[model samples]
Target: MRTPPNEAVATDTVDEGAGPERTCVLSRVVRPKDALVRLALGPDGQVAPDVRARAPGRGAWIGVDRRTVDEANAKGRLKGALSRAFKTQALEIPSDLGERIETALRQHALDRLGLEARGGMLVNGAERVEAAARQGKVHLLIHAADAGADGRRKLDQAWRVGGGGPAGLEFPEPRTILSMALGRENVVHIALTDAAAARRVLSAIARWRAFIDPDAGLDGGDAAGPDAGEQIRHEGNA
Candidate 1:
């Protein structure tokens, strides 16, 4: 989703230039450096969320998730945001643009995290991560590229729910998983979100970690690890 130096948006919107000069299509509210995705129009004129921001031509941005994009498209906010961002002619946004964007983003997330895992940037399981942190060898906290709501919340809590408080506490966010930029199905892992190669995830996926309730504890007002002899996903959804 990058253009060039002085270009509108090329690198996932994580840069300092992206701050204070942007607004969300769904919120219509300008916000700071939080999670947001950038999209660019393809040569065919169809729009796609430029996961890597390497697409040609001017860039158009959209907030993550399908409903927001649909809302923008319906209310002309999608075009509005684009026109305002690019200062150009009308761009044709397809009805299925959301799905296409989502698919592209998901694939990117999966691929990047899969690579990180292979490159030894990932170490799953809470106990393992806890050990790494204890050893002071943990450089980041990456959630899965495909983590669901429940899992995402748990991981978030683990980040800010530190021993003392949220202040100065480090939250593990892999670059590939960044500010919550990329997403995919059935995948959840973390990597160095600040790294150049992993910069893609910092702007997109990292911010989601902040919004979700830390610890994603549980839904029940009364419950303790569920009933006995009840398997979780290995058996069925609780």
Candidate 2:
């Protein structure tokens, strides 16, 4: 059976010289920065999600899951963890930290996608995406959450024909959101032609999915989640 999209899988092995790893305050598991979300205290003593992991001051790392965050809050574990991590008991934990983190992750992923578009590393439309897949030039495929099944299947088949194209990601964002990000109308599918850009997009998507549904694995291969046929819709060429 395929793994559920919301099930948290074991962290992928981190290679040497990648970066420093941190322990999750909730799970106590050491994971790479991409596998965890960072929470930092602001000057006002309020806790905030640092999705970019570049916030100043001390930060506490936690597993990317709503349950883990909720459990920590309910058991007062997050409070204690923050106190210890920041060396202060005056920190304030927001009641909606989990929701905030979810929003931040989504925005971060979209921002990266926009960057890829601006850099000319992104391609859209079924025909263009399919052509790139057939040529094995697509480093990553991103299908909108509500993309049509027929189009997705055709592209997937072409990708396989090209000796198996790179991993495909089913983004949770709807077509409208994706369209807006790429400055196009009705963007249902996207292809990342540049390897570096694809990696950046994949990392952002992995972090966002991990936070919203920790059980969802980000193996960078087949797309997973809700059925693509449920909200099928065709889009015009780019």
Candidate 3:
């Protein structure tokens, strides 16, 4: 049975705002366009991921996980779906389309962090983040994958005390990657104070993580929630 795409609504932690709906070519399930990953067809009929959904013209959407997408591609299911979505059989689907989609999603998440940082929506450094978290000013918390366990615990406790949430989202990459993304040095932890900024970052991170590791819990918990990083786990469960 095909489930209708859930309606997107503005929330402090789920989505920044409401947007158009799109249908997933593979599952035939309708969903908020922002909740699905877009694939654009180029001039040469080459299909590519439009993670930002900024590409013009016709496009196909998919709400499935990376493994499913890869399996479909290998078995020609994706090709057939794309053919129907694009209304033609002349398009070319890259063998590494799964890799491409993952890469694009990863980059988009990083880019969103950078943009938020540049706009002064987030603060880095353990001390600063801890201070913000303690004051109840943090809307979102993030930690590099390689962040020390002790450090993460301290910050998570502080965040909870300050009313931030359960814990922070773990970036798939290490400190070096986060540092480069935010144009900082050794960015181990970050705190986003603005609600809209937090929503955007959470949305991007949620989508990326969902495709990469669907079953992983937010902050290693059995389940996820907005105040407890629920949006990340819920965003891509399409």
Per-prediction TM-score to the true structure, in the order listed: 0.50, 0.83, 0.87
Candidate 3 least-lDDT 10 residues = 1-10
TM-score-better candidate, 2 vs 3: 3
As for lDDT, the candidate ahead, 1 or 2, is 2
Tens digit of per-residue lDDT, candidate 3, span 120-218: 999999999999888878877788989998998898889777755666777788999999999999999999887667777777876777778777743
lDDT, candidate 2, at 59: 91
Clashing residue pairs found in predicted model 2:
6-215, 7-215, 8-215
TM-score of 3: 0.87
- The residue pairs in collision within model 3 are 5-30, 224-230, 225-230
Candidate 3 Cα lDDT to native: 0.77
Report the C-alpha lDDT of model 2 over 119-222, residue by residue, as the tens digit.
99989999998897787677667788888778778877776555443334678878999999888889998988766676667667767777776555553334
Off by over 4 Å in 1: 1-35, 63-65, 80-90, 125-127, 142-203, 207-238
lDDT: worst 10-residue window of model 2: 229-238
Taken over the whole model, the C-alpha lDDT of each candidate is: 0.43, 0.71, 0.77
Q: Which runs in model 2 stand beyond 4 Å of their true positions? A: 1-17, 218-238
A best-first ranking of the candidates according to their TM-score comes to 3, 2, 1
**Backbone clashes per model, in order?**
35, 3, 3
TM-score of 1: 0.50
